[model samples]
Every structure is written in C-alpha cells, then in structure tokens.
Target: MLVQNSLSEVLRAREELFTRTIWTDPTSQLQNRVKGSELSRYFLLTESERIGIEQTIRLLVSTTPYYLSLSDPTDPNCPIRRMIVPTAEEAVFSLEESSDPLDEERLSPVRGLTHMYPNRVLLFSNHSCSVYCRHCMRGRKVSSSGERMEKADLETAFDYIRNHHEVEDVVVSGGDPLNLADARLEWILHELNQIPHVRICRLGTRNPVTLPFRITDELCKIIERYNDDNLSIFCHTQFNHPKECTKEAKDAILRLLKVGVSVGNQAVLLKGINDDEEIMLTLHKKLLEMRVRAYYLYDPELIPGSRGFRTPLARGIEIVEYMRGKIGGMGIPHFVNDLPGGGGKITIGANWYLGYYPKTRQHAFRSAVTKKIHFSFEPVGSDKESYYPVLSEADWEKFQAE
Candidate 1:
C-alpha cells in the first residue's frame, strides 16, 4: 500500500515537473538554483548542492538541444526519478547491472546471513536508509520488498553463525545499520559480543554522513563496551565531494574516534561525481583530518541500472596512481573492483612494482660485496627484473652531475 501510494505521488509529481520543463536536460540544470523561491521549494534542492546543480544546468542549457526541448516526463527532477525511470540512461545502466553483483545470495545459507570469505560473515539487519543513494547496490530491495530483517530473522542468522565455528569475524551491515533504534542496536552488539568466536565486530553504516544525529553519546557508550582488542567499527560512507564533508559529519566521525571505534570509510567511485584525482585526494585528506582511516575507494558496483555511474577501470587506476606518492600512505585507500558474480573484492590499483622483489631478512640484496658472508645477492637478469631496480652508483653519479 505504501509503495502504491508513493508511486502515485511520484507519478503526479512527475507530471508537474515535466510540464514546467524541468525534466528537459537543459532546464534540469536549473534544479539547484531554484531554491527558497517557487522552483526550489518544489524541487527540494539543498543549500550545499544548489550551486553545483545550477552550474550544471547552465552548461547543459548551452550545449545540448535534446535536453532543452524535453518537457515534463511525469516526475520532478530528482534522483528518485532518475533511478526508477526505465528509458533514462541510468535506467539502461541499471538494466545491465545485476542485483547480486557478487552473487551474495548464493552464499546466503539462511535468511539474512552471507558467509563468503573464510572466518568472516556479512549480516543483513535493517534494509532502509534515511536517504537512498541513486547508485545504491541494494536499491532493488530496500524501500520495496526487501525491508528490515525482523528480530527473529536476525536471531536465526545469529544461530547460524554460532553453529558455524569458522565464522570468527562478523560484519554487520544492511541498508544502513545505523537506522536501527539505539536500544535495538545495543542489544545486537551485546549479543554479538557474548559470542566468543565472533572476534571482530565491524559495522557498515552511512549514518555518520546521512543522519549524524542518530549517533548520540549514549550510542557511543554502548559501542565503547564492545571496543576491546577485537571489535572495530567500519563507518562506510558515500561521500563524493568536498562539499559532502560537512562540519556535522566531521563531528560524528570525531565522536566515533573518541569512543575508540576505529572509523574507516568506503566511497563509491561514481562518474561525474568523484571520478577525479583531486576529489579523491581531498576526500582522503578530510577523512584523515577527522581521524577516520580511508578504507576502500570502490569502483561503482554493477547493480542493474547503475552502469551510468561507473567510472572506467583505467580512470580509477589513474586516480590511485596520482595519489600514491603524492599523499601519506595511511590516507591512500585501496582502489578495488568488486568482481561480478561473487569473485570478491580485488585490488585494481596501479602496481608500483612491475615484478616482485623477494624480501630477505639480514642484508640488502645489492651487488656491493663487503665483509658480509652468510648471505649473497642473486641477480635474476634484466629479463627477470622484479620491480624497478635501485639506482646504480653510476646512475646516481650521472644524475648528480646533471
């Protein structure tokens, strides 16, 4: 009934949006600038995003006729329309995308438990986020049929994990784990802590970015109890720009750090959003400043209808390489591609080394023959050159002369 009602409202809203020509490619650009006045109040563009939206509109207006000629398409100019419309480019991308990109369901032995990697499991708790992202991998389920798992469902998942001794690490994630009520969350954490085999408890939530108000002092205290040696919190965020990193989000991250929850972020690499090296570096720096470690800079998942958002593999690699020596190692998150059909996350970043440098213990593997005896250097020849070789003395001398 709710979906039906929402769908009706969305349809009616679309008609109004299209008639105003806001759905037209060029007019859609004005969406961000329509604020406070008639156009903005109707469109729901936030103050932080308004300027960027308007700028995009201005550019589109000058460049494309296809965008300018379009009139109402039965919905307003918003992400929701972009996500649901089948004929849109996003829709085409979505059609090509898979719901279980990694084939997570095959690993789900029970209702909500996914045992993929060894000693680790992913638990689905709540399935609704405060603000749904257009490129959300779980968009297929979340707001529609795949709502939050009931307490009983969670208990069943817990039983499955308890019986399976192999599951030592548990990653509790859902639409956004933070959406659960504080009391319910605490209960879940307490139960997970009681399981001795569940050595590490990592949470995947976007609340710190979308709804920071949900993270209260009381919630931090509850988290502190489980913050011993094994427990950690992975605060997965969806920040795409410097503008998204607001002061409120920073404060939430600081509190998580203060409570000894090792905070880390996971960002989706979306096209036309944060596909640039500068944006990536800026985001990493901001996270470090907030004491949150950068974790994964994910290539947008191939969830059905999400193809439009993905950046090219080469672009992703380029971004990572640009940041490698430019910034601190701690701030550089792994650039990874979550392989289709459950192959699992694979690091796709630039390999600094063309080959492997066999690490030896006592001495450096150099041609310098000193009084050192027990160990000797082995040259694999230029054919088997592992990694970039250290600069030769002659090479260094020539460089100095230059």
Candidate 2:
C-alpha cells in the first residue's frame, strides 16, 4: 500500500515512502497541488512568477508528486509539465470558446444524465478528481466543488434509465469515479446492476495514472463482484503521454485486469503535449504493452480557458492515418472529434473519397496506404441483399457464441 500526506504530515510518511517499494505522493498527497518546488535556497523565487501562479490557481489546481516528477523543470515546453503546471495562459479565453462545448445540457434528460445516442448514455457521477487535468473536456465542471453528484441526481439517473428502454450502456464518468470511497462506488454499482436494461457499465477515471494509491484491494473486490455476465463493468482511463505509464500506474492497471475488469485508454490530442505523430505512436504502443486496449484518441475541445491545448484537426487525422499499417489493430484507437454543439463523436481520419460522378457513372477513391487512385462504375441490376455481407439473427447469435 502507498501513503500520501498533507504539507504538515509530509515528514511522518517519509520513512514509509523511502524504505518501502510503495510510492508516496511526490508532491505531498494533497489534491490541491501548487507551488512548483521547495521554496528553499535552491533558487530565489520572484514576485512576478508567484503572482502568475496565483492567477491560474483561481481555476482548478491539482497534481500528484508522482505525475509532477515526470516533468522537466528546465524545459518550459515539457509535455508532462505543461499538463500539470498552472500558468496565466489558462486565464485567456477566446470569443468563440464556450463553457459546455459539447452542449451536453442540450442532450441531458436530467441534470447529471446525458443520453446522446440511442443505445448509450452518460452518467456524470461526480466531479472531484484527485488531480485536475489541464486538457479535460469537461473543464467547466471538473475539479469544482459544485460538480459532485447529489442523491437526487443519482435517483434521477436511475429513473431516466428505467424509463428509457433503448439505452443499453451507461458510462459512469465525472472527476473520477475511483475518487469516491470504495463503499460509495460499490453502492452505485450495486444499484446499477439491478437495472436489467443496462448491459454495460463503463467507469471513466484517471486515478490509475494520477493517483495509484486509490486502487486498493477492497476496490478490486468491488469491481470483480459487479462484473458478472449479464451486467459487465469496464474501466476507461486516460494517459496522454508514454511517461505516464509509471511503475505504480502500471501496477494499478494490472490490479484492475486481475479482477476481470478490462481496461482501455482515452488520450486527448493536446498541442504541446501529445499532438505529434511520434509521441502518440509511443503512447499507443505503451498502453497495449500494459495489456490495456487503445480505445479513443480524442480531439481537444474549444472550451473556455483551453485554447492552449487545442490542436489542428488535420494533424490528428494524419497521425491516425500514418499508424494504420504500422501498429497492430489493438494498438490503434479511433482518432475522434467530439464535434461541437452536441454533434456526436465523429472520427477524423484520412479522407478516402476522391470524387464521384453520376453522369459518368463512376466513383474514385484515394487509397490511404498506397496513395493510389482507384475508380469503379456504379452498380446496375445488382441484388441488394446478396451484394452485402448480411448476417441473419441465428447467424449473429452463433457468431457471438463462438
């Protein structure tokens, strides 16, 4: 087990961290992580720098000692440092920016429940993450004390799911589901398990990377209990850079896998962080090596105070296209844009469509791998049923059983 301490309790936990293989909170265990380093004689701090840090502190402020240690103090553009370190760049908001870029409120049936797609829904469980991520999509709500889910909200979510028969999946997300005490999380999962309509329960959390100490043996038992055949539970974690795959992080992930809860990663494509092709490739490869599947490579949202992280959509497309033949299928995730204005997740990849003409009765496509042009004439007098690979109900059941 690992232990983290507040500033005052820092010395008490030092011996445990030093002597044992267990990791201690590198930045002290407090969720509100600010102040770059010790304010000792190592380097005289300036008033201007302190003032700048204070302004950014007005927004969400948090990071683990473990996550911060991955950064290079010398380089201003260090990807990990850019992620956790607060700066005045976050204070600036563009005119086109929005608080809810996805406009999730538009799709919400209730306050905390968002039913965007017919078959899947999102349960915004709570909003107190152990560490506040700089490039979080839900920047408007995350880390704020008001983001925590209330009893009424949970009841409303259950009611919404009960009423809507079309919904088969419920994505439990918030600041981080794992941030909740094991008992509270178990109660939520137990209630969710009672709903027969909910086939899958996916928990999206960043604790495995930012705060591995939370992955206790008790929590592992809770996951294993909820992950039965009828109602399945899966965990979705975020790790932007390869450096985030630290020993403790990997151990946390392995614990989940050991309990039969499959894990997957969803990485945001940030400009100075992981926007480059090589960085993304390495991140993807590392995720698979830990036995976690690469699920989604998300495009940064145009939210207020997040212009610093946004990357060109074209750059994301190129990275996905380039990795098509290079890595194995499990290593590749959908390079997706959670399109603005409540428009769903749209995959952004190399466009294969070149051109099509009705009069000439021809269609052209540019192959992504070979970069070669291919043309074909419009089909005439073809049987629609036989042309496509259509599976019957019995065949589908057989295939699934196999």
Which candidate leads in TM-score? 2
Residues 1-402, model 1: lDDT tens digits: 001224455445545544654322222323322221222223333332343333321111111111211212334433232321222333243445676777888989988788889889999887765545556776655655445598999999999888888888888887677767778888888878878788888888876765565567877888898777655544556555565576767877888888877888788787766788998899888878877777888888877655556778898888888887667888888888878888888998664432223442111221112312232344644444344455455544443354
lDDT of 2 by residue, 1-402 (tens): 112234344433333333342345432454434334331111122343243345552247566555555665445577776776555556677898888888898898898888888899998888877777777778777877777798788888898898888889999998788877777899889888888888899999998888886787888999899889768999999999988988888889999999999999998888888888888888888888888898998988887667778877898888988777778989988999888898899877776664544444455566666766666666875434244333345544443354
Residue 246 lDDT (model 1):
65
Model 1 Cα displacement at 160 (Å)? 0.7
Q: How far in Å is the alpha carbon of 132 misplaced in model 1?
A: 0.3
Off by over 4 Å in 2: 1-52, 353-369, 373-380, 383-402
Candidate 2 lDDT score relative to the true structure: 0.74
Query: What range of 10 consecutive residues in model 2 has the weakest lDDT sum?
Result: 37-46
